[model samples]
Target chain A: MTTRTGPPAPEIRHVTVVGCGLIGTSVALALRAEGVRVTLADHDPRSLSEAVRMGAGLALAAGEPPADVVVIATPPSTVAAVLRDAQARGLGAVYTDVASTKGRILSSAELTGCDMSTYVPGHPMAGREVSGTGAARADLFAGRKWALCPGPATALLAALTVTELAALCGAQVCLLSPYAHDRAVAAVSHAPLVLSAALAARFAYTREGADVLALTGRGLYDVTRVAGSPPELWIDILEHNAEAVADMLEQVVDDLAAVGAALREADGSARWGVVADLLVRGNLGRELIVDAYARRAPAEGVELEAA
Target chain B: MTTRTGPPAPEIRHVTVVGCGLIGTSVALALRAEGVRVTLADHDPRSLSEAVRMGAGLALAAGEPPADVVVIATPPSTVAAVLRDAQARGLGAVYTDVASTKGRILSSAELTGCDMSTYVPGHPMAGREVSGTGAARADLFAGRKWALCPGPATALLAALTVTELAALCGAQVCLLSPYAHDRAVAAVSHAPLVLSAALAARFAYTREGADVLALTGRGLYDVTRVAGSPPELWIDILEHNAEAVADMLEQVVDDLAAVGAALREADGSARWGVVADLLVRGNLGRELIVDAYARRAPAEGVELEAA
Candidate 1:
């Protein structure tokens, strides 16, 4: 029952992905499946060679023509520099970077004198615990949300091309501003990383030993599952969105302290109000997050909610 | 590669379960599968009838002969009272409970003047989002840890009988003391519940609306997954183990505050040390918890680690 109600789809015949990581290779493989020619590049020759071996795409050769779109799939810190270099080389008619944070990257790209009109900053809400080109799969973005945060100067053609690229890779589009994107991820993603780590860190310091660990159930397992992620990668992500994440973390700390105080109060019965309030809110919030996916499942078109 | 070095199994011909909730019914069903006659009881007649309909067991009849073992599967707050009443009625030769917390129930059971030597307190490390007999499964405890926290006065026969019961239900046994079990769960289960709720509560109050909700990925979803649980049930759990849960929550608050400060500091590069330390510990702790299960899989015998 859901339908797309915009202009005709832009033709994306050739695309170049700057980093042959999990996301880049997955994007290349996905587009290749749809008959779009994909060119791959990476600072590490092994990653580029592995992506090519995995049938993702051909390695970008020297003196190549400008492609329809160039995707910067590097880490968050390097996205702006890569975007500037790609634009300077006239790599594509439209440009986008698949970075987790948006505001910092957008501002840095602007500072580096990149053409903002041809750039549509985006992030795909799909990933695995493992990384690199070897772990990439074409179906990684099959049913995930691909967020497109376009600047005011971003040309409509550039936005349309990126949206079509997301669609071709089997993802729905979420439209929001750059600042909104960063804040949203800080609340949902970056903040949870620190929270999960904090919870798991308790397990590490416990003098009670393995028996204490033995008492663990599925709830603890699920809550701290992401705690085992590589620290270097998470540190970088947290650094870019530090302020927003710190704000969310402080909010969590306040709530935790309130609940802790309630639990330690002399009057046992009175503590229920403070404890139950946060829990009820948590239940409601969890439903909101879960329901978003349920509502978006049928409507494959762009969800146009911006800051 | 794993072998049992215990005495020959105890002959448990019949069993009586006092509460016909999810865990209680599952225990009865597991014993029934082992060719033991089972009798089920619940304060709610509807629950008793439903358990009977599901072939968990026959409903408890007036003046029935005492069974080999009695399992109390009531809520955490009501467990001690149920144990006292069951003991007064001469319910069975051996008695045990499946409450999540231990020290409170054991002390209360003693204060209420119940027989101490015959009772073994247990907690199955298994549950589902839904509760009650309707959601009960025969294999709910399969491959899960069933903690048996035997008091100093608890007889060997009583502890052995409960361990055998756990084995019959396809569970591995982890033996610890009452206070230790409470402290362990405070770290793993109870504390994680509050933490998950605190994380999810942010989404409930977000002014950014559905667009921010749409930005949620699997990481946030997994972290806050249990936040949707019923608050009344959780409040009761926290209240019973209030001090232990509060202690762990305070530790979490401290870690979060430190990380938040590090993120907000003026020096950008120096923050990695504090942030990465917690993440690395979190990684190690997660491995410890995961490895506990992996290590237990090959050995079905009791894991004898106590405080």
Candidate 2:
């Protein structure tokens, strides 16, 4: 273990992005736009060629000069393997992975006995319906939140390097423990996925669903649009974040029971009040979350419009 | 009982829309656009005048004038009372309503002994986030579904008049039993309201919600957008459709429990598979729903270069 402590002299001049997929290409483009030297690498030659065509980076050879910073933007399941391989080959001075769930990545690193100090785990809360390097845009991360989950041995220099990387991408960098990060994401992101899917399934089984669809409105669109997300990707994410996600699902069930009871009593006022209370509280909570992450424009008006 | 059967002739030359709110004004405007002479009436004189200004009608009247059709677009709790007043005053030859819930309206009509032959209950499944006559758009119901729940002894002429009204508004007319209408809507529309609110409430109770908001994405926005709906109106709807809404909520709770169990198991493959299955089926179900409605232009792809 390198016993070197404190911040290292800022020497990150050339950055390398591996995997050349959606997030990887986006980071490369963002860094390149800021006049940073960027190199691209990917096992898929087609994706590497696509990233190059998109001006993400200059294609680098296997034994090329090492970059100052390296970013791995592979899928969550493959993140640890890529990091271990890259570090063993001495790809860069410091490295990080931009995966959605962090706890699993940290655990993988620990189990593999990778150099924790040189590796920072992060997630940039940005994406669109489309995927791949061809769909990447440098502005993808603008005004978005990029979370950094640094292990105990993470050097201050490595942390600063990652912060500067986020700044270059026009992102607001926030810090969180890996456990907290997983739990919070499970509440807002993973739970909603399952809920939306369940709603869709229920509609499919209903007899009048066809007739109902003829009258479908924006309300249904807003609620179930995410149900169209890639199933395989979601399955992987849920599996990795099962513990925290399950807890959130329990809370949702409890609330649903209250709604059911209010309906059974035919208490219109209570039923409406129950739903209204949840919506109002959600609006307020969402506002706070957006503000802290600086994800939205400053709240200028009465934010609670619906509930 | 006027046992008027078979296809009723189109005798509704002049139509009057009472309660100049969003639905009422939109209906009036749509009819007027079809070159039908429309008369506007409302308890609020200002609202009445505003409807006329928006070309909803030629005049604002205190009492029902000579007309063939009358549309009552008041709140659910007030539907019975409004119908009683309209019928007592002989508003028109054929009468209908534009309330969200239908069972209560039908019940109210029965209790008041409103002329069943002349009364045809209906609801236009169309609206926006904004409210009032000023927010009313002429094409609000264009290519949308309009459901009609007619009672026994209803004259064939009244049904034809209502169908013509739906066509004039560019909507597809559907016939359903009042119970079915309430039950279907509770599953699709009312339940979403409760679910959205519940999600918001859960976020509000979290200590890290503020932090979480900073990391929010489009996923949260799409899911909780409806949680901002008007509380008073929702309360009225939930109360009116309490039984149907309650049953749907129970089913949702059961689904949530099953999902929770899947998550708690050490092997989350089954749970993950369940979620994935739901999403896949939901995608197909939602697509069918959208297709059953009018088709909108697909999103155009724009070439996004690095910033």
Clashes of each: 0, 10
lDDT of 1 by residue, B1-307 (tens): 3576777778898999999988899998888888989999999999999999999999989899998899999888998899889988988999998988999888898999989999999999888867788888988888888999898899998888888889889888888777878888898889999999999898896666577877777888889988988888788888889999999999999999999999899865767789989889988787887776565453455555546
Candidate 2 docking classification: acceptable
Query: Per-residue lDDT tens digits of candidate 1, residues A1-307?
Result: 4676888889999999999988999999999999999999999999999999999989999899999999999999999889888888888999998888999889898999999999999998888767889999998898788999999899998999999999889888888888888998898788998899899888786666577877667788889888877787788788888899999999999999999999999865767899999999999888887887565453465555546
Compute DockQ for each candidate against the true complex: 0.77, 0.37
Over the stretch A159-254, how does candidate 2's per-residue lDDT look in tens digits? 778877876887767788899889878876888877777666667766667765644677777777677666777777787888898898898888
TM-score for chain A, prediction 1: 0.94
Local accuracy by lDDT, each model: 0.87, 0.77
Tens digits of lDDT, candidate 2, B137-236:
8899876777888877687778888877887887766787788788878867888767776676676766666666656777777777676666667777
Best by lDDT: 1
After superposition, the stretches of candidate 1 with alpha carbons farther than 4 Å from their true spots are A1-3, A205-208, A296-307, B1-3, B205-208, B296-303
Candidate 2 — which residues are off by over 4 angstroms?
A1-13, A35-37, A43-46, A58-60, A205-208, A266-307, B1-13, B32-37, B44-59, B205-207, B267-271, B290-307
Clashing pairs in 1: none
